[model samples]
Target: MERLVDYLAPRGPLDWVLKTALFIAAINGLNLTVEFAMNGALSMSLLAHVQTTSMVAFPFTLFALSIIRHQHRLQGQLKHLATTDMLTGLPNRRELLRRLGEERRSFGAFILLDIDHFKRINDRHGHAVGDTCLVRCAAHLSGSVGPGDVVARYGGEEFAVLARTRDPAALEALTTRLCEPFTCTVAVEGLTVPMTLSAGVVRADADLGYAELLRDADAALYHAKDTGRNRAVFAPGRPAA
Candidate 1:
């Protein structure tokens, strides 16, 4: 019974229509049976009344179903807007923080990646090209990161990746993979230009707060940018080699 209610609850108008139909049918059938038992004949007027009630119920049922479907669609769209980056289609900062809180206990690594000289690109090529670079960088990060990794846009050209693996080697390798030059063909003056990225990786431990992890990664990223662009830096406390 509970399962039936659960199923019917979601159906909204369709369920109402079905219940109304069944109710009208039951009442009409019962009335006809009583009439035949009492007067030895069934009445056509009783059947007509049931049909009229069914006709009246149809429009209300359809309206209810339409409302439910519209609500379901709206909820889906709202969820997407809340969680997804509008520019790059990656998970946004809010979703990233939510994942960090949820997976901090289980994950061992947090990486913060930023596009090196992103402002230069925007200044030289325009915001349209800058947006293209961001989108391409997001794709590269998504592809380079391992399965079950949480990748998110941390605002502007910066991105965050949370990985669960305990192996520092694996994390470093992933960082190296992301730093490789990305070639995006931007339509600038009827010509195309390429892009590159730099990344910083930090290992998460019980001693570190999520903010501290981000800071560490940001520090490494700053180092990477300061020394040279298109490089990966691992946070201190990992081996020098």
Candidate 2:
């Protein structure tokens, strides 16, 4: 299911095809042998030819099946790699956007968050520590949001969350946890280092397109950053107080 490109045909039947074809071929060969024997037309030469054909057909069929299985597994692995963030093990931006596009009905909110002064952390602690910080943040965000929500790494120093909840208080609480010092933290060279998050959120609507909502969310996030970091701003309406 990872890819639509079926190497063998109208999709989802490669195994069935292999099994059915082998069964039918076997039945036909047996019928031909029985008929020849009954008619006294069976010859050693004909029997040998049938045996040789069976030997070639069986191995080739098995080989074909093995190749298909290998290719299918490889395709799945490749798809997973392409869509997932390696460090965080979360969906990457592409997957997030894909979901956004596929979702026709409105979800409650689209939230975008950025680490406050992330570059400073990187410059001071080193890239490895910075990476650790991101990993920890990814874990915290995904865990805090729960299974109902989609939390993803939205590229460097940023993460995205999509949820279908109408409660503003819940969104506010989620944002507060994200921005709270030590909530999303990492151990950098034996010292615990905490990071603050700034977020932009937009209420989803049936009227709005995915890109439009995302742009609004991005704007709201910058509003949070501009007014002061470590807060969530609701776009084009008012910053969440």
Candidate 3:
């Protein structure tokens, strides 16, 4: 009984319509079988009845197509939700890695950026202001990237950018361009604070692979922090061809 109820349960208006249409089709088929058994042939009146019954089919077809379209739209929404970070509205780690794998063959650059003194911001002004600061920085970073470039929140206060280019000179110039905009400060929740970030860059290449690229970028980020805040550093290695 429970299984029967589950089978009959309506998912939505379209679902109800589809189920009702199928039931009607089944009933019509059964009636036609009974008539054929009694008369050994379908009379003209019975044929007309079947044709009249099939009039419902046009609407049922439209309903079924609409249900399929709605399902596809729902799947797309689910995919987007799974790939997006809610806090900063940037791509989440999973999405970032997916893009990285897709763009692996194409020589590109990965930049790891962290807000300078992020913990200090959270400690001084509390977590609310820290959240605001993160959102602001993410917005800035997203706006700075070129079309087809990716900016993702890599958990905590760190974000990563995937810039599609191989040339060290071009990547370096793009990195510099990205870094230049954060010179301004953010005003959030009655607190005015500088949005300083230290960035580490690694050029994706055939030799190093992605994990090493991430490690190198992280090391360079720490180097930038150790030397001076609010600067960008590139991992030192064989230049990509």
Candidate 4:
């Protein structure tokens, strides 16, 4: 039943029209089969009947297609809302984790970072400016990564990056690029907000389990924060390469 409904609900106008035509042909064929069984003969009147039935069904088919298209669009919007962070337009944690599970064996490294003094910014400048700063910073971080890499909003004031390459030097360079944008003060709503990031990096080459690797990266992040913020730290358990 669900499959039939899905097949009838085509996603585009051309598909809807094609499917409707095929359905009408099937119905006309069934009618001809029954008429032949009863009278043991085919007639030209069948053609007129088929044409009239098709014309009668056309407007109703078009109406149903419109409703189906609208439902498809609404489903897409709801899926986007579920997987995306509304504030920064980045993938939310659920989406990130889902992607990570798919790419765990293939991904080169995982990076986790967060604003150094985000709470202070929110307290001093109010939530509005802090939100503006977050939006700007998310854009900056997104621009620093390669096309294949994934950057997502991990949680409040925190971001995660799934690096695509296994090269240690490239990973280091990416970390620097991620932080470079915040070296200067960001102006949001006539307020100057100084921002910096402390990141933890973990290479997946060591054959560590996904959960363990995340923990190592988190530990390294705290290590950076403990020593001093604004620097990126590679997990001690994971080698540079």
Candidate 5:
């Protein structure tokens, strides 16, 4: 019974279509059965009625299929929303942490990036402009990073990137690539403004926990923001607090 219920529960558009086809076939078969019982012979009138009913039911079957297809598409979209940042279209903090745990055994680097003086932008131009700046920064980071790299929105004005790589030079190059100047036109009170970012990079080893790597990367990020804006800091031997 459980298996039958599972089979009946809508799996997807194909499942719904198959079920609808079977339902229509069953209805036609029942109609034929009743006709044969009453008339003792197959009649052209009953066959024609069944054909007409099938023709009419075809559109209803397609409509059911369309609804199921739409529902599955919406489910996919909801899953994406749960895992991704709405503003930057990057992975959300939850996903970033999840990936970090998944890749802890492998050789990789964890980078924490934050927009420098982001609050200042909000104070001067307003929150709307600040949001625009974040979105633009996200686009640049997404483009600058490599295919295997994972970029995520860690929080407000903060982002995290994870990449599987062993070479320190390659990691350094990635940090440099992210720090390059990016200009975003943010409309504030009918005027446009620009903003920049600062980042911190830390390589993760087999011995380090994912949380520790995040802490180290965050420290480096704070260091960058403190010394100056729009720079990258690499934490090679820093211990997590």
Candidate 6:
């Protein structure tokens, strides 16, 4: 089957060539074994026969590798499309949730941020300008987070940051950094647009599931939106059972 061939195919260029050579050698050995069994003697013609057959098979081997490589590249692109936001090129909500579930047992902080008056921007400047703002916002958040942390486009005008750390000071530092004013402005159609973010921060307990983590963070985000537009609000920690 095509799937089986793809699964067995080597991923790297050198590996594929090496495997192809080995495969041809294997087939040649089998043919020689069968020939010697019946002919009762090996002839010098065997060497010439192998050289001729290998030369004949080389083109087919290259063609097959080309197909396999194309399929692999396509599969990789599909995976990226599934997990990434097309406009922002950041991880999407689905990918963030997947990571949250995986890190449920680890103590961390979950922060949800929304662009303040994002609809106003869309209405006033059109969706194209709004999209440009979103792209710039994503770039800023992506650059702000630590290497181990994840920043994702949670949905339209909203983003999520998952920081894997137990220290409260570290969490506070991150929230403070996010709450600080964005240093850059989006330039679209010769117009400068300023952006501000409102965020909800929640401590992730080891025993807490991702569902609860999301819920707590959402509630905090609501608090931030309700209290003021450009601020971060911390959700109260879950009481010990």
TM-score against native, each model: 0.72, 0.77, 0.72, 0.85, 0.69, 0.82
Decide which is better by lDDT, 3 or 6.
Answer: 6
Q: Write the per-residue lDDT of candidate 4 for residues 1-241, one digit (tens) a residue.
A: 3445555678677887697787677767887798889989867686787887788767776777677766766777888999999999999999999988888877899999889989988898788888888897888899999879989999999999999988889989998888663632445356567788888898888989879988999998888788777788899733222
Q: How does each model score on lDDT?
A: 0.75, 0.78, 0.77, 0.82, 0.77, 0.80
Instruction: Supply the global lDDT for candidate 6.
Output: 0.80
Q: Candidate 2: global Cα-lDDT?
A: 0.78
Arrange candidates by lDDT, descending.
4, 6, 2, 5, 3, 1
Off by over 4 Å in 4: 1-13, 26-44, 181-188, 237-241
Range of the 10 consecutive residues with the lowest summed lDDT in candidate 5:
1-10
Best by lDDT: 4
Error of 1 at 131 (Å): 1.2
Q: Which structure among the candidates has the greatest TM-score? A: 4
Off by over 4 Å in 1: 1-62, 237-241
As a whole number from 0 to 100, the lDDT of residue 27 in candidate 4 is 66
Which whole-number lDDT from 0 to 100 does residue 116 have in model 5?
A: 75
Candidate 3, residue 9: how far the Cα is off, in Å: 22
Off by over 4 Å in 5: 1-70, 187-194, 236-241
Give the clash total for candidate 6: 0
TM-score of 4: 0.85
Global lDDT for candidate 3? Answer: 0.77
Candidate 3 ranges beyond 4 A from true positions: 1-54, 181-188, 237-241
